[model samples]
Target: MTVKYLICGAGPTGLGAANRLMELGENSFLVLEREAYAGGLSASFTDANGFTWDVGGHVLFSHYPYFDALLADLLGDDVLTHQRVSRVRIAGGWVPYPFQNNIRHLPPEERWECVRELLPGRRPEITPANFREWFEVVFGKGIARLFMAPYNFKVWATPPELMDFRWIGERVSVVGLEQVLKNIILARDDVAWGPNNTFHFPLHGGTGEIFRRLAARLGDRVRYGDGLARLDAEKRRATTQSGEVIEYETLLSTMPLDLMVTDVLSEAPNAVREAAKSLAHNSVHVCGVGVAGLRPDPTCWMYFPEADCPFYRVTNFHNYSPNNVARPGEQMGFMAEVSSSPHKPVDKAAVMKHTVQGLVNTTLMRPGEAEKAVTAWQMDVEHGYPVPTLGRDAALAVIQPWLASHAVFSRGRFGGWKYEVGNMDHSVMQGVEWAERMLLGKPETTYGA
Candidate 1:
């Protein structure tokens, strides 16, 4: 069969493109999703025990007003606003988020160490060549060694020496020695540092609810369980796993760019394949720790730099929404994320057990509260965070243009291969912008080939 437009994957990016196409009065389009359901990585799941868990710690905060309006349209009054109350576990205590900004909360000696490295002559004078060096040059060895280095390595599962530092942006809060000392001297906590300081979530369902609603709005236009298995870009044709062949005028793919180029597309150039090889990604294991009793903690999420926890971060899912727990305000749900790659391999079987012990070790759980654990629902995602390695942009430079030349726009979290702009809002906008680019001849602002 033939269609005017064909989209691969039903995630935020694919749904965003399809929705924008409909809004632009284009209905002769179809979306093919491999998953039985929509929402992709942003999808949520309800465990056997009735506890709701998201793929990971996904909070909604958009840089685009368009995204805000879209959330309002999709979720309406069902959304809950939250001021982020995040913290870091370090030196056997909790310091506020942006660990460097709140080093004052550390023990006196530890605080002095963080400050000592930031002093006039402590930081290196050489230009940073990689993420590791960049943190050292900017944050000094004390803060880098304490939080930045270890925390980033845990989350990315890739050595910082192989990663790029330009992607830090707002994701990593940068502070000077003057400001760091000022806060420590005044005993102040800089909790409100990032754009996600205020965010939103669905009150009933997890983060996936928004996308589920969007896919429903698209109705029969979305075909689930039919994944794009093969694509002859030259002929503008796609073959789904279910053996249906679709000939499209334009193709928008939200699948991983590496897979799209190496696995799906036919007769890709050697350079493109090599560039795809250069793209590295880590796998994420999301373990939802459900407890029988509730705690009065207001902490949204906590970061773990210490090796005591197998997971890099854990979100207080129950606090995000009471409905997230089986018994609303009576139960608790903790969602922990552990990233793994060749450099940092994690035993999948031990993640949940280690995650629970991590909660206790990090003081997130009280003594003997381990027996209160009811459900340890987990989901292992093969492609989690797209590591922004030193070669990423150059690799994208090679792969993206080739795909675009073939009337194939691969745009999304992995499709774009840009972690800096790979958030939910940016992911959706990348699709929206791609649709605008295709139909209206508008320049794509969110992501570019």
Candidate 2:
């Protein structure tokens, strides 16, 4: 008998698994996507003027050999690889990124203050019990106090002390203590580390094109706009919003963890459910402001760790591809990524108004040039980055195993709730690995390995 499989959530992970199964002559699989599109949060939208913005700022950076192989297989030479050039905007200065490694760029008196704080004699011995502690240990009080602390607070929307650091690894590059001291004295800039040191982007399409290509390859096996409303784990079945019942021998879910635990399981394990409750997340509002003129800066993306700008980062979308927006000489656009919270009502109009104002404030757009060159503006909000808090590990420990026992594989940015493995490459490989585990009985490498 052929093994029957049901893959929920047609995001990258689900598609990865489905694609893998197909590759291995094991094609007994069905893909269900809630959204009308296939990319999940990685999806992009095009406005009336043809300005395209991803759900949030997304870059194609892969860590696995399989990822490179798969992407090469899919897009082939259509992919354009670019070197990562990044910097942190702090205290009205464009500090070289990996801020801890470039402390020498600071002014003399301020540099003295930072160095004085890091003095071996002056450094205090404190057991770093949280993320903040771990960060300070590597960066010291000077760098952490100046940028790490406040910037992290804004990004995570919680104190770093409330977060666990086990997921740090290669996700966040740490400056060598010796190099920090050497750079401080010599004033050198180090830009070698970080995951995206050398990354690739699609030449003619957005990141979603990767998914669309996958879905296209799947053909009729992939279904879209069919959201999962509820599930009966005991019956190994799920009900879509369209009231269609999908039964399967095994279920691979790439949906949010909270939805699975609370809505699917009978009585949903309280400990597991509550741990998910403790997990916090931030929403991303991606604004695509188009101008009918030449492109802006040549940079791929710029970081804003400062409070002067509302956006944490800005990607020159037009830079990614001239085709990402209107025709050449017809005008191009830029994407501003502003994070928001459900706790506070996001003023959509204000977001646009201030976003344009912010462009001028940051010299992203020259005075009066914006009005003349600007043709139209668009905004899209996606439940973006997952907040890694202290409670995550404990909650995941309870929730993950419970789903696994039921043969339900939960994976993806929101599904797995792991910030470290939340990127496009990671999430896609997760789905691929999930299929290998189920079909080929391979070991899981995403969360466990």
Q: Largest TM-score belongs to which candidate?
A: 1
Query: Top model by lDDT, which number?
Result: 1
Write one digit per residue (lDDT tens) for candidate 1, span 138-204.
9999998899989999999999999999998888889999999889778788888899999999998
Instruction: Please list the residue runs of candidate 2 whose C-alpha ends up more than 4 Å from where it truly belongs after superposition.
Output: 1-3, 184-187, 264-266, 329-332, 342-346, 373-382
Model 2 C-alpha RMSD to native: 2.4
The global Cα lDDT (0 to 1) of model 2 is 0.76
Find the 10 residues in a row with the least total lDDT in model 2: 373-382
Q: State residue 244's C-alpha deviation in candidate 2, in Å.
A: 1.0
lDDT of 2 by residue, 17-58 (tens): 899989888878888887888888777777676666677678
Instruction: After the best TM-score superposition of candidate 1, give how far the Cα of residue 435 lies from its true spot, in angstroms.
Output: 0.7
Off by over 4 Å in 1: none
Total clashes in model 2, counting residue pairs 3 or more apart in sequence or in different chains = 0
TM-score for each of the candidates: 0.99, 0.93
